[model samples]
Target: MQFQTFSSPHTDRPNSVDKVMLQVILALLPGVLAMTWYFGPGVLINIVIATLSAVAFEALVLKLRKRPVMPTLHDLSAVVTAILFAIAVPPLLPWWLTVIGMAFAIIMVKQLYGGLGYNPFNPAMAAYVLLLISWPIPMTSWLPPAVLSTNPLDFMQIVSAIFTGSPPTGLEWDAITMATPLDGMRTNLDQGQMISEISQSPVWGDFGGLGWEWVGNWFLMGGLWLIYKRTITWHIPLAFFAGLTGLAMITFLFDPESYPFALFHVFSGGAILGAFFIATDPVTACTTRKGQLIYGVAIGMLVYIIRTWGGYPDAVAFAVLLLNMAAPTIDYYTRPQVFGHGDNHG
Candidate 1:
C-alpha cells in the first residue's frame, strides 16, 4: 500500500521580488520629490550615482562568488538598497563617499551575509551608520532648505560640490550648509536652553523643522499608499509610531521644557522614514505577525531613548541596527504552533 504525501501548505504569493521593489521605488517618489523641492537637486543626483554604483558593486560581488549576475540585479533589491542609503546620507555627500557606502552595503553587509533574504540586518541602515561614524564632518553637513538657504547653489554648483568638495567661487561651505534640526536641537539643549526658547529659531516649523516636516509628511503619505496597496502590512509601522509617540507624550507632559512634543518627535527627523521604510524591511524585520510588533516597538523606543539621552541627536540607524540583532530571537519566541499541535505560553 502507498500513502499520498505532500509538503506543508504554502500559499503562492502573487507578489514577486521585482514587483515589490518596483512598488517601493514608486512609493518613494512623493518624498523624494518633496525633498528635491525643498532642498535642491542634490538628492536626485545622489540617487542616480548611488544606484549606478550599487548595481556595479552588486555585479562585481556576484561575479567574484560565481553567482548569476543579471538574475540578481533584475530583482531590483540592489537599487532599493542604494536609494534608501542615498536618502539617508546628506544630499550633497561626495560622490566617492556615496560609492564607498554602496560598496560596503552591497558587498560587505548584504552579500557577505548570503544576500537578500539571508541578510540579518538592513543594508541601507547599516551603511548609513558606517558612513556617519566614518565621516562625521561630511555626514552632518546637510544643506538648509532652499527657502532658508542664503546661497542656493545651482545644478552645476551642486554637482561641483559633490564631485570636488568645493562650493561656488563666492560661496563658502558655511554659507551653503547647516546642521539638521535634530542636530541643532541637541546642541541647544546641551547648552541648557529650554525647548520653548529653542523652538523660537527660524528653523522651527509647525511641528518639525522648516521644510523638513513637509518632507516627512510626503514620506508618511507614500508609506500609507504602500499599506493600502498591500505591498507591506501595517503591523510594524503602527506599533513603531505608537511606541515612539507614547514615550514622547509621557515625557513632554512631565516637562515640556525639556522634551519636545510627541508630534514633533514624529515629524522632526527620520522617525517617519524609518518607521515606514527602514523598519519595514522584510528580510531584516520579524517574520511572524506577533514578533513584528515587538521588533518595531522596541526599535521605536530605542530611537527615542538614544536621541533623548544618548550622544546622537538622531538615532534611527542605531536603533534599527540594534533591533535587527533581536528580530530572530523575537520570531523564535513568537512562532505560532500548528492548528492540531497546541502550545501554551511559557
Candidate 2:
C-alpha cells in the first residue's frame, strides 16, 4: 500500500483569516461603545458609513481585478479596516470624505499592492494619513465630549451633519466641535501655559481628557482580552508602552512644568488603540519575535517624538507607517537561528 506525500507538519492552525478578523472586531466593540457614549451616535454613524463604503469599494476592486469577490469579502478584513478608519476620524466628518477614504484604502493601499497579505503599509493608516494631510479642517473637526458640548448632537443632527456638513437648525459648528485632548495640550503648551493650569480645565480628566481617559481604559480592557484570547502576543504592546513612557518620563522629569505627565501620554489620543490593534497588524508588522519588540518600541518612541515636537498633535498613524517600512529590515536583523544549523553552514 502507498501513501501520498504531504508538506511539513500536519497540525491544523487554530486561527483563520476570517476568525482573526472576527475576533478583532469583537475586541473593538467595547471601545466603540465607549466612544459612542462619550461622543454620541455620530460614532456609530461613522462606523456604518465606513463599513458599507469599504465593502462596496473592495467588491468593486475585486470585480475589476477578476478575482473571487465573496470569498475575500467573507474574510472580514475590509470591515476591520473600515472600523479603524472610521474611529480614527471625526465622527462628524462628511460622508463623501468617508467614502473617498475607503476607496483609497481598499483600491490603492490594499488591492493595488496585491490584496491583504501583500500590502506594505497598513491600509487604514495610509488612508487616514491621506485624509489628514489632504483635509486637515474636516479631519480635525472633532465633536466635544457629550459632557462638555454646549450642544450635544442627537442622532438626526449627527446624521445631518455627516451628510450635509451643517449643524442642526439653531446650533453653530463652534458650539459642537472642540479640539481633542492631545491637540488642546499641544496648543496650550505652545502658548506657554503650565500643565497644572491646563489640567484644571473642565475638559481635563484624571489622567487625560474627560471621557477620553475612560475610552482609553475600555480599549485597554479589550486589548487585554485579545491577548488572553491568544489573538495577539504581549511583546509589541509591552514594548510600545515601555518606549513611550520611557521617553515621556525623561521629558517630564527634565521639567514637569513644561511637559505633561507620562500617564497623560498613555491615556490620551490613540496610544492604547495603536499599541494593541494598529501596530500589531500581523501582515505589516514584524514577523520575528525579537523584531516585534524593536518594531513596537521604535513606533512608541516615534509617537512621543512627533507629538512633542512635530506638527501633528497625535502621531500613531505616522509612527505605525514609519515602522511598517522598517519591519522587513528589523526581521532580517533579528531572525532566529535554526536548530542544528551553524553560522558557517555555507
Runs in model 2 deviating more than 4 A are 1-9, 13-15
lDDT of 1 by residue, 1-346 (tens): 4444466545544539999999999999999999999989999999999999999999999999999999899999999999898888888899999999999999999999988899888999888899899899999999999889888789999999999977779888788899998899889888999999999999899988999999999999999999999988999999999889989989999999989998888888899999998999999999899999998899889989998999878899999999999999999999998787666645
| Alpha-carbon shift of residue 126 in model 2 (angstroms) | 0.6
TM-score to true structure, per model = 0.95, 0.96
Question: How many backbone clashes are present in model 1?
Answer: 0
Alpha carbon deviation, residue 222, candidate 1 (Å): 0.7
Global lDDT of each candidate:
0.91, 0.93
Cand. 1 Cα-lDDT: 0.91
Off by over 4 Å in 1: 1-15, 343-346
Scored by Cα lDDT, where does model 2 land?
Answer: 0.93
Q: What is the lDDT of residue 181 in candidate 2?
A: 95
> Against the correct fold, how does model 1 do in TM-score?
0.95
For model 2 the local lDDT of residue 124 reads 93
